[model samples]
Target: MHKDRIWNKWLFKVIGLELVKCCAEFAASVDFKRDYLKILLSDYLPESDPLKKWFNEGLKIGLEKVAFILNNDNQLVKISDIIIDEVGLLTRNIIPNQYIKEFVCTNYSLPGITEQNVLQIFPGSEKLKHYGAKTLSQSDLKKISSVRPFSF
Candidate 1:
């Protein structure tokens, strides 16, 4: 039951290239054969493209922060080129993890205003209201850490 394996091709391709190099390096321990070629084509291709580099880097950051839940050497995460190509218009390529989480939660909490440029141009619109942008004062944001448990 493989449900549309997206990154497997790239992974296999990578694996094949390594195997080829490995066999060449240690020819005594390995033999090149037609059956191996079948496994090579089926399992891996050398020039497979990967997800976007920036997004991959971002995932690497997260994996590091969380005690290396994943192998950073392997691009386990999938970032489509379509999305990468659409960066800046739809998203920034170099956002940090805190910014990413904040973006997700803030947007999910208010569908009207999540990274949309509604607030910059149209200040007090309904979308801005949903985002609570008006209420979020510079002072309040700056002093969020200093505010007491029940302080006003």
Candidate 2:
């Protein structure tokens, strides 16, 4: 039992570190997508249109500032902090507890379990294998939530 506990501790630590790395990469990918979309839209706007031109210039400057921050060795940490705070601000609201319970029921939350059977299946797998899990971005979740009755 002691050996098993030690192994579980080691497993959890490794899993936690990998999850953190995956989350960071996911956040970076999201930032890249946002910048890429802004740049592409800026290019599509006609230069002759004064309003669009102004918007384009602003977008370009914003992109350059982001690049500068990302390129600097010392700014990476600060940028990470900013990203975390901005995400928190952008997504301050969480799914309400009542809505979550309803969603879990309506969406096949765990595929084969339910509130009624939860107790029975609570410890079905004591020694679980790590087959990996899919990672979704906030936008992806938003798209999914839009399709559903609830919004995350």
On TM-score, the leading prediction is 2
Put down candidate 2 lDDT per residue, 3-88, tens digits, no spaces: 33555545544443343333334336755522322212213246554444444445433333332222113222211111211122
Residue pairs of candidate 2 with colliding backbone atoms: none
- Kindly list the per-residue Cα lDDT of model 1 for residues 16-130, writing each as its tens digit: 3454333223322335321221221221112233433322333333222322101122212211100111123223323332443344345334323333221122211222232
Q: What TM value does model 2 have?
A: 0.22
TM-score of every model versus the real structure:
0.18, 0.22
Error of 2 at 27 (Å): 2.0
For model 2, state the Cα shift of residue 11 in Å: 0.8
Candidate 1 ranges beyond 4 A from true positions: 1-3, 28-152
lDDT of 1: 0.28
* lDDT for residue 22 in candidate 1, whole number 0-100: 38
Pairs clashing within candidate 1: 12-44, 13-44, 13-45
